[model samples]
Target: MENKDHILLFRVGKSELERIQQKKAEVGIRSMAAYLRKMALEGICIQLDLGDELTEIRALLGRCSSNLNQYARVANTSGNIYAEDIKDLQQLMTEIWDNQRALLKRLSDI
Candidate 1:
């Protein structure tokens, strides 16, 4: 017969601990030990660079809002709107939607 007797332990700082928890949550893993084991064995980690995409989306939304507000002001003051402005707004909205869709697809691929 064989007996199993072993223990493993380690210490991590508050920030390091928080980062571990965050990674677990991001990977949809519930067990901390299992997550660490898998990472240690397989050397697998996911690092997403979503900041640029988010920034671009935010800027696009800001532009859309500003353009809409300008259109509203013009319509209110003069009771008239131009076709070119409407077309430009539509183009901006399309770009925003397209970028959002791309981001979603990238996330799904992960």
Candidate 2:
């Protein structure tokens, strides 16, 4: 990758700016812009720490899909299906279907 210099702007008190310069010198960071960016990135990264959340969501979706298919088949076959029960199962299936469509759309966009 090509390295490019980007101009950044910051506002700080005189004392704070002096402290920053002193620390940059101590760390042998000659360019204030580079030094500030490096230190700021070290302190915070945005694309963070979602492995557990992703795993949990995956498990939940798997279970929901399995139950949805099972219930859908039962509702289709069972001769004495109550209206409310059928509606409930259909709603759950529809919700899962909608979520799947939305997920696919987002993946395609990405």
Candidate 3:
């Protein structure tokens, strides 16, 4: 994302400004511009840690994919596949899917 260099302004009554401050406090948002932008554009705004979690999940899946590729190479070179390695890979996949489902459910709640 680019830094927001543009400016936009509007006037509001004193009471309206106070109300906006109160809402920002209640929402625990520190950035007035960000809070206002979300309120104006989205109608409803929420703060969720899902972005961080999803990034972590993506990293984990990348590692899992790398490991799978490594195992495939080993199997091709050795003419063998280990049952235990397959089970471990399956378990890892299952856990990743379960986490994705949970995250989706949380998003659906919003």
RMSD of 3: 13.0
**Ranking of all predicted structures according to lDDT, beginning with the best and ending with the worst:** 1, 3, 2
How do the residues 6-108 of candidate 3 rate in per-residue lDDT, one tens digit apiece?
8999999999999999999899989998899888887765888788669867976987898899899999999899998898788878878888888989989
Off by over 4 Å in 3: 1-42
- Give the clash total for candidate 1: 0
- Which candidate, 1 or 3, has the higher lDDT? 1
How close is every model to the real structure, measured as TM-score?
0.65, 0.35, 0.57
Per-residue alpha-carbon lDDT of model 2 for 1-110, expressed as tens digits?
A: 75766666779999999999999999998998778878987855445444655565576577667766776777789844567766665676666666666666655654
* Candidate with best lDDT: 1
Q: What is the lDDT of residue 59 in candidate 3?
A: 76
Candidate 1 residue runs with Cα over 4 Å from true position: 1-7, 11-39, 42-44
lDDT of 1 by residue, 1-110 (tens): 54526556899999999999999999998999878877887875789999999999999999999999999999999999999999999999999999999999999999
The TM-score of candidate 1 is 0.65
- Give lDDT: candidate 1, residue 9: 89
Best-to-worst order by TM-score is 1, 3, 2
Query: In order, what lDDT does every prediction score?
Result: 0.93, 0.72, 0.87
